[model samples]
Target: MNEADVFTMLRDTILAVLIASGPVLALALIVGLVIAFFQALTQIQEMTLTFVPKIVAIFLGIVASLPFIYATLTGLSDRVFDLIGRGGP
Candidate 1:
């Protein structure tokens, strides 16, 4: 209802999103970096090499982290819903 409350809500939402995405993004980033490094050392430049592993890693990461992601998002939703139920001053 107020500027502070609005900003706080926005911050919480953004943080929740970032935290929820962290696992997948981090896995992809690490896999990509490792593949790039290997390619650099071996001089084997294959586009599929980068795409395939990252895809698999991301998929696995998402499956493995689903619960953590759900909890993070659910917590944010609960807070938001509770805020709405409280009514603004």
Candidate 2:
């Protein structure tokens, strides 16, 4: 493929990754921020406190968002396959 095709593929790949990860990453960010706020308010500087909640929240978020993530990835994969099948530029 030429530079344009390579760039387009790269862009699509990055966008797919971002879409797939967006929900979990957003949940982690929100959970971490809330935990930080709680820690600051109570002065409980426990490392495990932050880790556990963030992990749990992110896990749940991933589980909850699995269908959406899967659909996005499937669409991207289909698009990539279509490009390849058509003898990508």
Candidate 3:
């Protein structure tokens, strides 16, 4: 593959990775923010308080988003395989 083709492939792979990771990352951010707010209001300075709830919330978020995540990954895999099959470059 030429440099241009390699660059394009890398770009596409990065985009796919970002899109796949977006939901989990967003969930983590939202959960963290909410936990922070709760800790601030209640003055609960327990580290476990923040960590446990965030972990649970992130786990639940992952469970709920599993289907979408699976689909996205599978789609990306298929696309990559197709490109390879077609002798991309």
Candidate 4:
């Protein structure tokens, strides 16, 4: 592949990675923030309190987003394989 084609593949790879992980990461961030707020309001500073909610939220987010993640990865894999099959220039 030429430089432009290589760059395009690189961009698509990054986008696919983001699409695969974005939901879980965003869920963790949001959950962590919410837990921090609640802790500040209640003055209940328990380390486990933050851990549990964020973990659960991240897990649920991953489960919910599995299909979308699968599709994105599959699409990326197909494109890469197709490029290989065509004897990439």
Return the top candidate by lDDT: 1
Q: What lDDT tens digits, residue by residue, belong to model 1 across residues 1-89? A: 99999999999999999999998999999999999999999999999999999999999999999999999999999999999999952
Q: After superposing candidate 2, which stretches have Cα over 4 Å from the reference? A: none
Could you tell me the TM-score of candidate 1?
A: 0.96
Compared with the true structure, what per-residue lDDT tens digits does model 4 show for residues 1-89? 79999999999999999989998898899899999999999999999999998888888998999999999999999999999999784
In angstroms, the error of model 2 at 60 is 0.2
Candidate 2 per-residue C-alpha lDDT over 1-89 given as tens digits, one digit per residue, 9 for 90 to 100: 69999899889999999989999999999999999999999999999999999999998999999999999999989999998999985
Clashing pairs in 4: 1-89
User: What C-alpha lDDT, on a 0 to 100 scale, does residue 21 get in candidate 2?
Assistant: 99
In model 4, the runs with Cα more than 4 Å from the true position are none
TM-score of 4: 0.92
Sort by TM-score, best first: what order? 1, 2, 4, 3
Comparing candidate 2 with candidate 3, which one achieves the higher lDDT? 2
Task: Give per-residue lDDT, candidate 2, residue 67.
Answer: 99
- Candidate 2 overall lDDT versus native: 0.94
- The per-residue C-alpha lDDT of model 1 at residue 78 equals 94
lDDT per residue as tens, model 3, 1-89:
57998787778878877887788889889889988999899998999987887888788888988888788788878877888898984
Separate clash counts for every candidate: 0, 0, 0, 1
